[model samples]
Target: MGLQKYWRIVFVAVLLALAMIYREEAERIVNIVVSSPPWLFFACLFLVVAEFLLQALRMKLVFSKNWAEILRAYAVGLMVALSFPSRTLGEGARIAVMAKELKVKKEEMAAYVSVERVADVVVLATAASLVLLEVHPFLLAAAVLGICTFLAVIESDTVYRKVSRGPVPELLRKYIEESRKIVKDRALFAAILGISVVLWGIDFLRMWVVVHTMGGTIDYTAVASLVSLAYIVSALSFLPGGLGVYEGGLAGGLVLKGVPHDVAVAATLYERLFSYWLWILVGAAAGAFKRENGSSSTA
Candidate 1:
């Protein structure tokens, strides 16, 4: 644990060093954000709140749980995701927390979370591919084909049955069974997809607003594609909340699209301020509150 803590300190120190090395750029970025109109900041904040509410609603729809509980679980998950190196563990944390809170089996909750994650990935990928269609037609085709194939496999009971019969652990079998039930529900699946579309749309709009706030002009599609690609790359990087990878990818992408370097950096920082850092703070608060209540109950 000491070694782990040491590495974390080193990680933070590295980030600080990088900031110091680019102090001029950092100052310029801060100036750009500070000079932005207050209304745009409010707009970004509104979108962030909307995202949280929508995600809670999505979880409620999937698990039939109270929205408040779902929101708390989600917040804690985000906090864990940012705290740890692997973002995947955040979903695992969400499953564990929600299952314990709602008195449901972990496998069952895993199924619901899986559905939510898969739907999000598919929707985001499709949207990104569509936006980049002019820039990458092959990418659109590949995305569509991959999505269709994945949906077909998941929709197939025969495939599930075959997989289930072949040395699958009992826990996994249960998870698969629950996932099939959720996916087979056409109405629920459609609603989830719709919510996902709106959620990602809000993400794009928020990015657009941040870029404009930094005095940069870029097309909506470009912003969407850039953000989407950056998210994918950062997730693959497995860094905490994508950390350095996300900022670098986003700022670089923006610069490639004709945004000034300082403006790009400013836009990325401002967007992350609301989207990533704000959530981390909220998650930390939620986690602490939960722990305090648990202690009080025990006492």
Candidate 2:
């Protein structure tokens, strides 16, 4: 195996070692999972499936494509994102699928996908800000959104001219210009953000239902930020599916927010079980069906 693959394996091994360290808690976590309500589990699973559809629609709104094709592309990306440690594979898959399926220009696809991620962060942080109620965090989120907008709004030709004397690459120039064009589309920009809010809102509510089913209750508004922050923490370490790390961060965060530690852990694990591991399983099934059906003519 290549050194990179070896490193990822080592990270997985580290994750395993950490799980062993918490072996007893892990056992209890397992029991809790085994006993979770079957109906509730299915409901949460349905929510996850719906969330995927909504997410694909969000992407399509910003970059026009047949919805089925875009969804297949996202499923392919999700499969790799779940199976690997690196975060970029899914993005790389997204670009490749769009190029292959939608004939989207690579640079243009990159520009819009990058913007979509920034917009996702903005929208989630806004949801987080909703319950946080702290002016400083809201201001910080606003600053982040402002910077992303600035990048998207900057005149690429002017930027290139200013740095033309430098060693900037042609590809970077194209990407920047594409981003500028995408963000300048006021209608598309508004549509993307609007879709984003709804997307993240549903995502947070999915978690709320899971927690509620587990006999834990939380402030309705806090669900958005809690869910957002938990996910943000999971992605931060670049571990595929966040594995053991998400449990700690999520449970700890919930404990700080007044949930009993045991309840917090149970809720986190249940939600992750559905949203992470089961998500990968569902993606694989969907991908198989897509392949068997061939690309939809509509796609």
Candidate 3:
């Protein structure tokens, strides 16, 4: 974890250095970026909204009710995660909000969130592995390994038994057992994974739209690989919201893939504007509308 911290810091430093050296190219890109049409701007916003909407949908699928409160908690928690150091705080905030507002027990909620994240890793890594096969073989291999590793950890009785013997109070045993029960309902599990895929697909499309809005073009397959690459690299960063690392990886990756430097930067910024900044704005509103804490409902 410490090594990952330094790696993120180093990634930022390196990206900044590259930006400085290519200042002229970046400026020209920004010039073109400023001319994006309003329709395209709104289209990007719609995709961003859709992404979170799907996220909310997934939460509802998992928890079944108290949706209004769940959505609020998710938004506020997302805000916390993005605003604070230790991106893990975002997950903590979700658990906190649900516990405070919906009367969800911490252990069960923690299990829900953990299960979701592990499932996400498997889905994304598998997707990235396949998409990157021709573009980046090493990353493809790593992604495949990540999928396998996450599954192995989750499925291993040895890991569960070992944790049970340790100081972990719940040992996630209850959570894991519950998760198994949930997945046993095939229809529900499919719906959840389906929502997740769509959510991430919107994310990719959001970036693609931003690039097109900025009058740039790249192959869809390559763009998907790049987007997945950026997400994979930045997801592990300890940086608050994976801030610079995500943007830098995205913009830099596009440029490396033959996109004009300025346009790549512009598209990345626009995508982040709607997805990250606007997302926080909505979360802020959700937090404000609620009581200082959340209201309880039967979920």
Question: Please, what are the lDDT tens digits per residue for candidate 1 over residues 43-160?
Answer: 9999989987887788788777776677888887666656566567656766787687667899988988888877787766765774457667887677668767766767898999
Model 2 lDDT tens row, 67-136? 7778877776666566655456646765766565566778887887877777787776666664444536
Error of 3 at 185 (Å): 3.1
Residue-level lDDT tens digits of model 3 in 1-299:
35434644675687578768998875676677677777887887778777877887777787756778777877876766666545676567666766565566776677666666755665666656655776678976776677567556656778767866777656466766566545556786677777877787777777877776676778766677678777777766666677777888988988887887778988887787776677567877887777544344322
Write out the backbone clash pairs for model 1.
Answer: none
Choose 2 or 3, whichever is better by lDDT: 3
For residue 135, give model 2's deviation from the true position in Å.
Answer: 12
Ordered from best to worst TM-score, the candidate numbers read 1, 3, 2
- Model 2 residue runs over 4 Å out of place are 1-24, 62-64, 88-90, 130-167, 286-299
Sort all candidates by lDDT, best to worst: 1, 3, 2
Pitting candidate 1 against candidate 2, the one with the higher lDDT is 1
On TM-score, the leading prediction is 1
Provide the TM-score for each candidate, comma-separated. 0.90, 0.79, 0.80
Q: What global local distance difference test value does model 2 have?
A: 0.70
